[model samples]
Target: MLNKLSLLRNKIDLLDIKLLEILSKRLELVKKIGLIKNQYGLPIYVPEREKYIIDLKKKEAKKKGISPNFIEDIFHRVIKESYYYEKIKKFKKIKPDFTEILIISHDKKISYLFKNMLTITGYNIKYIKEKNLNINNINYLFKNIGMLILDISKNFFEKFIKKLFLLPKNCILIDLSPIKEISIKKILKIYKGPVLGLYYFFDYQKNFLFKESIIYCDGRKKKYYYWFLKQIEIWGLKIEYMSVIEHDQYVFFIESLKYFFTLIYSTFLIKKKISFNKVLTLFKPISYLNIFILKNFFLENPQLYINLITDSKNNIENIKKHLDYINNLSFVIDKKKKIKIINIFNKIKNLLIFNK
Candidate 1:
């Protein structure tokens, strides 16, 4: 009986190997289909076709006395993989219109940082000093402008607003102004072009790397979005598309509030007359962790931080509502409920490894 059991186990292992080989062959065919679709300018994911294939697979599985749920799960995973491969292939085929990026800025530090970042990616960048940008000669300024970087001071933005309308209809705008949402809306009214608002604070000398910038577009332009995404990816930067309101709310809660609390904590520490060295010694683990975070994530640009806080202050009512919701949260632990939750998690873990 033991010999028979060993033989059966060996047979099962052989069958598993054969199944994996067949799946590999299937994935090769799927990739070929993805390539063909890309060549024809067709969408990679067709829900109707996917549903039909899955339904046919289910019927075949049922006929073979196999579980439908297992077949469905396997096919869903295959579909997901196909979608991912197809999207990557599509991005590889995109041809951007222009190569030169025109940056209009007076801030030497900020412009220099951007220029260096873009230059590494083989992008030809032209800098037009803010003083040189005049409303009278706006047309001359936009001669070969494919991408325009707007980084003017908030105080001087009013004069530049009207001149932005003269930008060629196809030119992409990257606005780094203080008030982004309002500025983008006004620009979109006249210049029916791609507009992106990028917000971040970074100072390499100070070891402050608030390198994560949130991006929001004025309209739904997939081509420009894809182009910008690829360029930023080359620079090792991260971006996500979100509504202006959602972006502001996220910045308010995540950044401004965190900075405010940090200030409050530091004030109390100073009041207690605790030296930096004493605090570091007292809370070695936490101090080390916070130092790492400050170097990696904290904003060093006071102007940007203040602007974020000011934006948050403008939405005080919404912030208060969220604060009230936070206050309502409880950390009470009930033994029975905790046990039930643990059991549910265990069941989920088991389900993940069910077939295996």
Candidate 2:
């Protein structure tokens, strides 16, 4: 029996070697494809092709009596790895239209991420912490800067608004604040140059830029910043143009409200003295997902979430209205108004379904 076990292990080791060789060959092909795509300024992610490959593999797996879900899980990881390798492969260098880009942010992680991403694409990038910004350094740094990215907190940006005159007149200014209303208003008042507001909707830690979404609002001259938009597209981000008021309104619903509910739920759990481990053992998928989101939220700086929730008066007022609605629902439930509650639920369900 021991000898049989040894033989089985050896067979598995041999199969692993073959699998590695196949993966290496596949990655080589992916790199070549990346090169060709870069040459033509094509995007890295093709959703249609990805969907076709996964569906095809799932069909083959079912015929072979393997679990289709198992095959799907494997292929998804493989495709994600393929995308990472494709992006890291040497890109066809495009000469940047701008001279030097300056990134100002209090957050080191965000600043460095931007610096690294732009630097790899052959753009000259400089970074300065918000604390380091002064009249002298601003003059020195803005001398050759054709593009200025403001990635600082909203509060800091407000305080720094008066110093906008230090920047060169021709430099394109881009704001990366999540809440756009205040920043856009303040910036427009101070700076007359080409301005753009960008809100990134992906994890900053992601290694590849494939299919990431960026919602941008036009602030000033579009012609001056057109090349900058093209540069971002070449790096594989999907851009959506929105008005500043519309962007802020959506952000209130999507980000501020979502985080507010998560916080309330977490507080309820804590107040009830619920054991998180016991909850995990219950094996509820939806609960698990909620817990996962809550855990991830706490991993980031709490101040970031606080700033997001309290950034605008509109967000605060909207959240209050939601709470009032919830209170009315609770009163209806207590009064045993089954017919009214049913109507309300149906209306909400239809709204959600119709939007989808």
Candidate 3:
């Protein structure tokens, strides 16, 4: 077994060296071609040429017994990174002819954050206030904008939708999910694909990728994170469609509601002026576990505590559900009740594991 393992490692090492040499030669040739293309003032990227190369690579990958999907992803990132470097170097040489995206919002802080993210992701981002954008003549912006990031919470949804109807079918209209109710997803489906709001999350290796353009979330990074992002692009450079209302609805169940419950419990203790010592004395195990979760939320995403509670379309009534249940003790006193509680707890725990 040891001998076989050593032999396999040797084979892998040789393959790695061969791959590096091949890449070095390919890059040298690409640079030579780039020089010629530069002299002739040809485009930095030729989409047709790219398509042809991808087709050829797909055939080769099949012949080599490689997973085409895996090979394609590797090659796609290689090509994208190469071009990204070129774009940065010759930034002035290429400007997207189309407007790409136009953002109109009532909140300047949120607007600035969204625009900055787009700029980093290599887009020409533009913005206008809601009232000014509502004019009839400037509707041309909608015609060419491939994506729209609108703030419809401040009575802007109807007006934007009115103008957005003029845009072409392939042109996408996007809105960041608002904390308030903004149900434009169903309406925009007429001319757009999946919704792209400010927040998207995907598991990447052991870490996570988060984009908080909507509710003012922070940036996250991991090795596998970019791979996850690139995978999402197949569905129109985004993962899923969501309106501001839809976003809030989904987030509430997955995130906001849990945070709210925990925050309220933590806050209630603070307001009533209860000490950590009292909690440890009464419900040692439950109280200790709860505090661990509570402390992380209180300290890390501290802003989240503020944003979620103050959210415009927040289900204050649903939050009341947790509070209503809080005082209802006498849980599982009898042996039969204890058995039922344990069974229910185990089932819920098993369900969590399976879903994850």
Best by TM-score: 2
lDDT of 2 by residue, 141-171 (tens): 7787888998887567767778888788778
Candidate 1 achieves a global lDDT of 0.65
Clashing pairs in 1: none
**lDDT for predicted candidate 2 compared with the true structure:** 0.84
Per residue, candidate 3 scores C-alpha lDDT tens digits across 1-356 of: 99999999999999999998987777766776655554444445656777787788988999999988888888877775555333322212223454567787765644555565456545777877766653567666766666566654434555556565676554544445435353444444454443433554432121111221123211122221233233223111234545456667777766777787777788898899999776777876756767777767776646545655555445676667656655432444433577767787799999999999
Report how far off residue 224 is in candidate 2 (Å): 2.5
Residue ranges of candidate 1 with Cα displaced over 4 Å:
1-99, 106-113, 128-140, 177-179, 199-214, 218-225, 234-239, 289-301, 312-314, 318-356
RMSD of each: 10.6, 3.7, 12.1
**Roughly what TM-score does model 2 have, to 2 decimal places?**
0.83
Error of 1 at 348 (Å): 20
Candidate 3, 31: how far from true, in Å?
16
Worst 10 residues of 2 by lDDT: 88-97
The better-scoring model by TM-score among 1 and 3 is: 1
lDDT of candidates 1 onward, in order: 0.65, 0.84, 0.56
Distance (Å) between predicted and true CA of 305, model 1? 1.4
